[model samples]
Target: MASNTPAPEAPFDAFGGGAGPAAPDTEWNPTEGSLRAENRSGGRHRVVKQRSNFARSSTVLGVGVIAAVGAGGLATAQEKPPVAISLPDLPDMPDLGLPDAHDLPGVGALLPQENHETVAEGRANPNPLTVATYATDDERATKAERAEPVADVQAGAGDAGEALRARILQQAEQQQASADAADKAAAEKAAAEKAAAEAAAKADAAEKAAAEAKAKAAAEAKAKAEAEAKAKAEAAAEAERLAKLGASYSMPLSSYSLSATYMQSGSMWSSGYHTGLDFAAPTGTPLKAVHGATVKSAGWSGSYGYRIVLELSDGTEVWYCHLSSMTVSAGQTVGTGETIGRVGATGNVTGAHLHLEVHTAGGDGIDPAQWLRSKGLSL
Candidate 1:
């Protein structure tokens, strides 16, 4: 059997087919490499190593998923209508560090060329490079075109929301100020009402006090007037009592000077002391009876010349001596205050005067002044 190991200097076939060696530092093209056949022996196939575009494509797809999630969340948050995105067509990009496809073996069909003969003949193969590009320059152009109008719509929504928030804050401030003003007005009204009520209460109290004082003063005045009326009535009653007593009694002489009293000690009398009351007057002065009486004797007697004796109804005797003359008989009756005789110096002579004496019913002499006073007479 032949050894299956190839020599170390042999060229590596990346496509698993016998082909020419690749140039140094050049990347293989997929459109040319994938069309070659694989070498197989028995049931085993040869393992071929080639560069793939999967790493770049997977990175682009992951970025696209993240970008899509962010865009969906922004749209839901804004809650705005979607706007169509349009962009101006960009100029063709300059090539990167790649050889011309025309120089590469069997890669001419992968690039867009000016020739359309194969396409018109319906024999052109599908180019893998132009298939759905995940991280190609053409994809970046499409994303930019869609994002322009979205940014404009988001900005407009933000401005409108800011204006609405400002208006709400202004309205709240105005309402608060109005409420404060109303509260202040209500408090002021309540205070004014309280002050007025206090003033009214004070006025009522003062009026009540004044009324009480007036009533007290009136009561006092009435009591004083009643006392004065009672005093005047008592004085009038006393005067009436004195008037009744005056009609029954009187003094013997209306005008006279007293010379001697009853029982006065002197050497000029028969008993060595005066036993009668003496009244001095001018000669012929009238003498009157002291009370209602009847004459017991009216005659001249020695040492008692020209005297008269009178007897009262109660059997009391009164004698008038030293008279100038007599004017009544022994049996004549006389009333009180009636003129009976005259005054003169007679019998036991002295100056012209009247000497009066009194005796009780037992014929015993008493003080005449005291006896007259007992009968309600002022001597």
Candidate 2:
């Protein structure tokens, strides 16, 4: 048999039908008996998800804390200027049917130690929630006072963070641009210096070549002048020697008219041409030694009525033919212009004349008149 009377203390079923042991009376425990019946609107109630104020506030503040910590670590590791981090906007906490903790007096002492600063100070808490169930009154008040300035600082930090990041990027770009300019300038300067060096080298080479060419030309000119001077000196010496030698020679005869010349063609001569120079004169005209010489021969010769031969110092021989008489004998030394013979009518001659012949050391005959003229004597 079932009874309609309700139990005075029934444990609340967390699941739909399960019942647990009754809790102690000293602590609060949810139970079906403590719950009140509500009027039905002819529809089942929809279940709604719920969240605590402390958990929501902690999630919002964690993001800001993590961002700040990461920025500080990056600055330390790189040894660079500290960068500002922008924190995300924290969403407003939803109303949870609970009273606002800030409106109640001494409400911070009732909140969990984790949510004490957030609930009492009416702001997000940067510190993580602690496992402690409650916070002291003094700790809440002190933390609440500190939280004001922290909020103020954070309010301005958003704008300051963006400005700082922009400034750092701008400074980096300026440094890079300056470095690029310095590199470009250095390259241009190096190119200019190289070009100047090459030009200088070319100039030096040209100057050296020009100097060498000039030196060669000067040497050639000097050599030519020396050769000209040597030739002039030799000519002057030869002329002086000939002038002294001319004084020693003399003409064969003083007074005579020239007749046949050497190498003259005549039928009377046995040879095809006359071999001697002829001087027409009186039968007894005197003949003289043409130069200083020894008498080589003085006698009658065939075809020639009389003849005399003289040999000079240079091995030259002079012959006087058709002579009437000869004053000098064979092997007699005579001075220049001394009497040696007389003119006469000789063989192959039409009238009285003196015939003269000259022979070189090799016995080759030459023109007597030309030989005499070469000794500075006039015909």
RMSD each, Å? 21.1, 15.0
Clash statistics: count for each candidate: 0, 0
lDDT of 1 by residue, 143-216 (tens): 66545544543554455555566777888888888989989999999899999899999999999899999898
Tens digit of per-residue lDDT, candidate 2, span 50-92: 3244544454344335434433323332333322222112222
Best by lDDT: 2
- Find the number of clashing residue pairs for candidate 2: 0
Tell me the lDDT of candidate 1. 0.62
Query: TM per model?
Result: 0.37, 0.44
Model 1 C-alpha RMSD vs. true structure (Å) is 21.1
Which ranges of candidate 1 are over 4 A from the true structure?
A: 1-245
Check candidate 1 and list the clashing pairs: none
How many residue-pair clashes does candidate 1 contain?
0
Candidate 2 Cα lDDT to native: 0.64
lDDT (CA) for every model shown? 0.62, 0.64
